[model samples]
Target: MGAEHYPPPWFSVAPMMEWTDNHYRTLARLISKKAWLYSEMLAAETIVYQTGNLDRFLAYGPEQHPIVLQIGGNNLENLAKATQLATPYGYDEINFNCGCPSPRVAGHGCFGVRLMLDPKFVAEAMCVIAANTNVPVSVKCRIGLDDHDSYNELCDFIYKVSSQSPTRHFIIHSRKALLNGISPADNRRIPPLKYEYYYALLRDFPDLQFTINGGINSIDEVNAARLEGAHGVMLGRAAYSNPWQILGLVDSAVYGAPLRSITRRQVLEQYQVYGDSVVRMYGLKPHIRDVMKPLLGLFHAEPRNVVWKRKVDAALLRCTTIKSILEETLGEIPDRVLDAPLTEVPSGSTDTFIKAKSLLPPPYTVSEEELL
Candidate 1:
């Protein structure tokens, strides 16, 4: 199917490592049917070498239909093989990871944001990935890296990749990655987010679709970005940390779908059934503790949340099933909190959006030097 046939990538959850796994995605799907979900970045070598164990790495529930599988690698052959291996899993899209700034990924692995330094290689890699998969192809990348953080340089990267490859969608993280000897955590915080660079891409590459990512938290902010001409907006830590608040409102607030009539208690009960089935079938491959990890944040910022969390911690040690965990801890939280429908909408801050607009760079134009 063409990109026009699919649901617009209006809002999505970011592909966070370790956190945006199958279990969390199952929970996220239960909350918002419209929000696009992303699998954690899997290395191409991991998929190529683990051919016998493909299901363990690439398998996802049928409900994760609109999901995208993100893969990272510097080699062309492995990228092709990985895309081929992942194609059978029915991912809606295959995204190349060009934005990860971790030392292990960008520094030693020589992929991720490091790939941005070589746009020709990225264009070739995208072509290889497109050749292998039946689904739409995309790249998730930082605006620039270190000394290359400029509007023209960012435009050059976008222009070459789009012009040379079949890939049309780009997810801009908005911040330039600092490759200096800093922790990955600091890379997210220390480098200031330059949303102007992302907006400028929209102006320069009118035909290519772009999704703005990084630092977007609430549903209100997601709406603000869409209003500001962003094709899409992605949420990272906020969505994981407060799935109820973030994902709960996505259907109604973001997609303009009907308000979800379900409550947290209903969500927990459904998740309980899923957890039991997986534990019964998989055994300790996904331990009971791992299955329950996503539930820890379901009651985020609610009344008696700490007490409920303490009960959850106590239950995790002895509980064998998700049912047992809920039975022991659910009562610590009141029915009013548990049974209440998600009605309150957070009033998000617009200071960042205002600042970004002020810093908007001039519309990109072909200079005479480039025209020659």
Candidate 2:
């Protein structure tokens, strides 16, 4: 594909650690074909030095296309090697990770948010990557780091990088990264989100596409950002933990396309077909759990789903095949899953979704239609 043919992402699923793997991406893709998907972050060292076959990092189904493969590293040569290797796998774009504040990413690996201090190096790396690959290259970054948390510094970083290379698409996490004394979890919360920084980026770099990230939950919020002139909005844990909420509604709400009139139950029926295919291809050793974990979030906010949730939780312990898990929940799978409206969120976060699961257990008391 030519550079002119590349489809600009208007909305994307953020590259999370374990949450956005191929199975989950496949499920999300089924929900919204237009939204760009991201693979979990892979270390460039693993790609260039450690792995003999690139498929270990590059493997994905064709339906998962328009996907972005995010790689992390500070070594220019290794990053170049990884980019060159990944391009032939048909990824629509490549995103560099510069916003991850985890110690393993920033401290131990010397990449991620630490790169914010050296935008010149980032520009140089983007040049190397662009030289090696034909697809659109992008950077996902934080607004600033510990002491460099100034708006001007943010502008400087943007100017230095985009000035040197054609990598104009950027995903900004909208927060400064704290490099010390905090867990990665705290880093996500402790640093206050300054969305103004992102708006400023959009205003200052008119030629660049800026996708704002950090704490955006609902389709309403996504629409607000689009109205505010953001090129895109990236949803992380919110998308993963409540896959149906954002993915289910995004088709009609964000894009002009009509909603996929299919119910959540029908979607699961499709997901079951996908799970079966995965198990048939990779066998039941580990793929079943991989297929199942992404689904725990789908039942969020549905009444009487506790019964269905408990069945899946137990399936993780008792079942080896996706078939068994599907069978376990078959009769229990509520019509609500088939008939529930795909509209606004029902007022709770993913954390609440986790806490509210599994309140009911036993020889299953709730009737199927009662769930409706």
Candidate 3:
């Protein structure tokens, strides 16, 4: 029943290209110290294509421990090269992305999802990485791709990859990656969620350590999957957008690690520091606006702040200070919510103690509709 009794290193964040960059990873670390955080998938060709600064793609901040690097590409030689460069950076795991459906990705004849037709290629690629790297090699794959909708095909591919490199773990994304004109966002929800497809995966491959991803929300849902014999749960948008849920899960739901807790106020404080650091390092330029994005819901309360959010969209723009954004928008965050430790929030007394409980979402800033 308890998460601890379930498995080791069970939950992870799927790599979202722009969304899961260093700034987000820094924020995620402040919440959960142990859950595995994945990088936005790095294109193997992109790494090779850049003439001089491959290090630009490789560098990550120090705070992002227990991290995995997700690489998208089907080219074995180039992937091996990228993995060689990535390994020295202290990546805890190297994951091959086999599920992204962007036509841009498929146009190059790479992207792991398309490798489904030739399970041998996926297996050979995994084998190459496993043989060359000392670190654990893993795969993140959709259940099927193109017109190949058979679960048997999926299992066949999984069996091949596992047969070649049993040391590698598998992360199964239950939806089939679409080839038609459907966008990737729709691909997530449009594929009818048959968690039973994932449950059947556990039934079929009892020898493998399988982690299921896509549309998994809430601790209860994760608990149900673990009961079904999944080795872990991988959360994508829910973990990225609402994030604090993942933090809460790390302590209460997953590790039961004696919580050295950080509060919502502390999170806000950290953001202030982060934004300031960006300004300082990037010379008060576009990076500040990029860094201030987490404050979106906060400023959504006011008309001017809404404009500020959109105007500051570039990675090069910087804000003078977020205090102005806060003051101009929601007046001032209620002292109770501002001061309260979100982890130990008193049942419903958030409403009783906080001054502006109705305006904010759950624990972060206020809803956008109430703009001033």
Candidate 4:
């Protein structure tokens, strides 16, 4: 293993902003203990500001072991300080966010494939974090940005940033991030993914650990990626939606890693425990709504379970009490979410339905300084 090993060829929860918060991570761990988890990408500046209550950002149940904290920022000193604050919470690794294409991130001067243009800074920042923290420091990045489409440029950029001195593992989201007025949603779909590019990273730079991310939604997609020689596969939304599908089977399916058996009902019950804890601790934020969303996939196939998911959906959308929502929608918690948002599927029309990506925010512009 590189630094520490919990599962071979680890899987990760991509750093989605509001979606992958502590509440969701806790719910996810209840589904799969071994799939590596990460916090939503936090800026070094944000961490410094929140260090007094570092527990807020760093608080994870002990059961969620081998979790990595994903952080962003170009300043080496701030990165080092943030890494120090993170270690006490027992992060297995520290990851720098070089992939996100948000304007807020760009306004602060970080993320986007913009960080790749200055691999030297990324390299030094990694060096500082790796030096200061006992935990491993890694990077999650895109191939390159809008104008830098040439595969050669991306390869050269990775070679420069891998900084193979110690921990040379870099998670490559094999697509270009177009940071214009265009949203982050389109960036994932619009940028043509060359899986060949992922395999090329392994062949060209065998010394570095290359994990493939982006557009990975299913087991078949994951298997195809492996055939291309990716060290590991990373999932963003799919893993979130089908946590059990990936985590429940991934241990056996992908890595021959240890398997844990947890049924669908069992998973839902576990989430309830988490849901209760979240309400007790953080009050109502976003995850109350998210926990309800995943349950929809559970009963989608079964006509009866579909009602439960729909009940959950109504409650979640209304931001109402679980008891009240259950009573109102399913008459008895219905057993699962109706498998699709009631508003969308019940009406079922493109013009009326807000698509999944609509839930995601737009891409950010990189400031001139970050471009440098």
Candidate 5:
């Protein structure tokens, strides 16, 4: 199928490393059907070397439709091979990771955000990946890196890659990565978000699609960005930390779909079935703890949440199945909290949105010297 046939990614969960795994994605799909989900960034070398164990890394439930597989690496041969190896798994789109600021990725691996410094190579890599797969290819990148952070430099990277490859979609994280010794967690928070750079891309590259991803937490903020002419909004930590609050309203609020009638209890019941089946099939390979990790935050901020979590932690030590864990903790949370449907969507701070809008920089204009 061609890229045009797929739905435009108006709302998506960002491809977080440890958070967006298959277990979490299955849980996410149960909440919102319209929001796109992305797999974790799997290095091409990992894909190539672990071909025998491909299913462990590449396998996802069929319910995760409109899913995108994100791969990271700088090698052309391994990238093409990795794309070919992943083709049979049937991802909707393939995204190249050029934005991760991890020291292990950008330092020893010499890839990730480092690829932004070499747009020509990134273009070639995209072409190679496209050649190896039938699905559309996209790039996820930071606005800039280190001292090279400049609006024109970002535009140059975008222009060179899009002009040379078949890629039309770009997920911009809206922050410049600092390659100097800071931790990846710090990289997410320390650098100021330059949403103006993202909005400027929308103005300058009218033909390409840009998804703004950084500091966007609530569904209200996601809609706010859409209102501001953003092609898409991708949420990271918020979606993982508070799936109920963030994803529960995505279908009705973001996609104009019917409000999902399912409650938190229903979601847990469905997930329980999946957990049991996986435990039976995979055995301890996906230990019950790993399967239950995603559920830890499901009851975020509700009454007795802390007590429920303590029960869950206690269950994890003794229970060998997800059912056992839930059986012990489910009673801690009230039936009203568990069974009630989401009706009231939280209202975001309008003052915060207004302040962000006021900081918007002017749209960028291409220089005549670069036009040649």
Candidate 6:
């Protein structure tokens, strides 16, 4: 396929280990239709060993399309088998992770940041995956690891992998991985982001599409990278921690898709229904907290948001059903918000935003007592 036909994603949510699960991706889709979503990194071993429950691992709704399945493992045969198994899931892309710095990932799994030491191994893995599946194959990597941490070494790694396989997309987290004695959270914070490395990647490989990741939290930063020639941006904690607030601006700011007029409360109601179906279908014991975990940041910056969060946290202790949880937490939003000014995304925004605002339904009240 031609370059134009394979348009790189404008914005994407990163494949965080425990956080970006299918449920979280589903919640994110409710926020932005344009942003590419990713699954939590699945080990090739898990896919190869667990033959009977692929649905628990690979199942996703069509609305989560343009999603990528990120796999982590070094065994070539198992990775190939995992790629073949993932083929029917309809993923738009398959990503190999070579950037994780967690002890469990690098030390125990020996596939994540450990692979950064052997670009040839990664190249071979990519070739196997590409040969097994028709979906686009890609890699996410750090600039370098320990002794191999050099600008030339980074270039060499990318050159080797891209030259050896059909892979054209490389998402670079602009930080070197410290494989020893650092916790994953600290690793994310301590590494000095060398985005200039990414700029050089864009300049050196005109034929490849590169998305920059790490320490990017704002729209201005995203646009700045785009202006400097990045093909896309991948957000992890910033997107997952406050998904609705971050993705709420993406339609107007990034993709220029028509802004959605849907409110957070409306999203909660929809999520409730979706959660009910998921639990019933999967035989998950009906727990409101499990269903509501992904919606933790929906009311992020609103007034009394702390009170709302506290209410939810407290409710989780006793609330047995989703209906009671929604009534106690989401039902707390004041009806007067219908008349109150929107807290942000004010009148100076684009016409699509303004036009979309006109589509919001007149807000109605929900009483906890009445809802029950």
Mark the regions of model 3 whose C-alpha exceeds 4 Å error after superposition. Answer: 1-7, 279-286, 295-332, 344-372
Poorly placed runs, candidate 6 (over 4 Å)? 1-7, 280-288, 336-372
RMSD in order of candidates: 1.8, 12.8, 12.0, 8.8, 1.9, 13.1
Q: Report clashes for each candidate as comma-separated counts.
A: 0, 1, 8, 11, 0, 0
* lDDT ranking, high to low: 5, 1, 2, 6, 4, 3
Can you write out model 5's per-residue Cα lDDT over 1-372, one digit (the tens) per residue?
Answer: 443555679999999998899899999999988789999999999999998889989998988888999999989999999999999999999999999999999999999999999999999999999999999899999999999898889988999899889999999998999999999999999999888778778878999999999998888888878877889999999999999988899988888888878999999999999998886355347878878988888889999999998888988889988998999889999999999898747655445445556665666666776566
In candidate 6, what are the lDDT values of residues 250-308, reduced to their tens digit?
77677765667777766766777787676635565434565677877766676767787
Residue pair clashes in candidate 3: 98-113, 285-316, 286-315, 286-316, 286-317, 287-315, 287-316, 360-366
Once model 5 is optimally superposed onto the true structure by TM-score, how far is the C-alpha of residue 56 displaced, in angstroms?
0.8
Predicted structure 5, TM vs. truth = 0.95
Task: Give all TM-scores, in the order shown.
Answer: 0.95, 0.88, 0.80, 0.80, 0.95, 0.87
Per-residue lDDT tens digits of candidate 3, residues 1-372?
Answer: 112322366778788887777777777777777777889889877776763665556667766767888887778898787777677777777888788887767556656577777777887888777666677788888888767876666766777778666445788887888778788788887876545556666656667778888877655666656654668888888776666655555656665567565565677677667656554353434355555655554322333544544544532233366544444433344555445453532212222112222222222122243222
Error of 5 at 342 (Å): 1.3
TM-score, model 3 to reference: 0.80
What is the C-alpha lDDT profile of model 4 across 1-372, one tens digit per residue?
233567754566787887777766776777666677878888888888986667667787887766778899888889889888777778788888888887777545755457878877888888888887887677888878878866677766676666433557888887888887677788778887765566666667778888889887765556555654557888998877666565555555566544554455566556666665555344444445654554555443445665566556666676544444444655443344322221100111232112321332222233455345
lDDT at residue 192 of model 6 (Cα atoms): 78
Residue 317 deviation, candidate 2, in Å? 2.2
**Which residue window of length 10 is worst by lDDT in model 6?**
347-356
Instruction: Give RMSD (Å) of candidate 5 vs. truth.
Output: 1.9
lDDT of 2 by residue, 257-364 (tens): 766776777777788887877763533333577788887888777765678778788877877667679777756756756577666443233332122122211221
**TM-score, prediction 6:** 0.87
- Better candidate number, 3 or 4, judged by lDDT: 4
Question: Least lDDT summed over 10 consecutive residues: which range in candidate 1?
Answer: 277-286
